[model samples]
Target: MCEIGGGMNFKRREFLRIVIDAIDGKTESIVVAHKDRLCRFAFDLVETLVNRSGCQIIVANQSKNAPQQELVEDMLAIIHCFSCRIYGSRHYAKEKVKAKRKYC
Candidate 1:
């Protein structure tokens, strides 16, 4: 529940419990420091699910950044991530090409 939201590797016990409670009409409100803190990549999905269950979500520290600025930042982050992955595998690709050339 207190784990970082970088990836989906962590065990989300409390989160699942909350969602179940929401579905069963047990929980009324879910407050968090930020919407993404509750779910990094699935906030919209979770919100829709809980909303249908009559549960309300509240973001304490709402983003002050403009929508355009946030979009640009998100795009840049994605590009940077893929760039790192591609460039990081350049050495592996070079090795594979060298091995294929040796076989030829």
Candidate 2:
């Protein structure tokens, strides 16, 4: 009864595969530690799918001492994404310069 999602690539997530299976009548209920722990985004769509299938979505840590954990994690994910975008653009620019130099 344990599933580990390696990263927040929602489309390629193995845990989401399980959720889809459960929604298709393979399981009775879907329990999670935190909603974002399973997905960084599009949780509403997942919740709707689970609801449409009449499956229960249980939150194990709905009440906690540190409520900022979710906020911090989301912030980190956003920052990581932004940084990667900057890195990729820089990399692409360098590659383009190299290509132009080679052509010239």
Candidate 3:
């Protein structure tokens, strides 16, 4: 299953389905072009769970440069996530202050 979103989001339905299928022994194997393509973090944990359930994760590329690229991607994703949260919180704070002013 291909996911357009960043691998950081574990709440994704496709990702969750794959994990459940692997745990249930329904999925024999999961193949990805790169390690981070499967997940950005906690890959070892997932691999262990899959292996325990008789499933395997096949990573086709193990290049030295892959980790560097994955790191860049992960950093960017983290910044974007935090920036969105900060912006949302600022908007909410403004709205709350406005409501208080109107009430006063």
Best by TM-score: 3
By lDDT, the candidates rank as 3, 1, 2
lDDT of 2 by residue, 44-64 (tens): 887788778887778787756
What tens-digit string does per-residue lDDT give for candidate 1 at 15-67? 78888898789999888887766765667888899999899999999989898
Number of colliding residue pairs in each model: 0, 0, 0
lDDT for position 27 in model 1: 94
What is candidate 3's CA lDDT for residue 10? 83
- Candidate 3 lDDT over residue span 21-83, tens digit each: 999999999998988777888889989999999999999987677878868977897898789
**Predicted structure 1, TM vs. truth:** 0.59
Better of 2 and 3 by lDDT: 3
Off by over 4 Å in 2: 1-7, 63-73, 84-104
* Residue 46 in model 1: lDDT: 84
RMSD in angstroms, all models? Answer: 5.3, 4.1, 3.6
Candidate 1 residue pairs in clash (backbone atoms < 3 Å): none
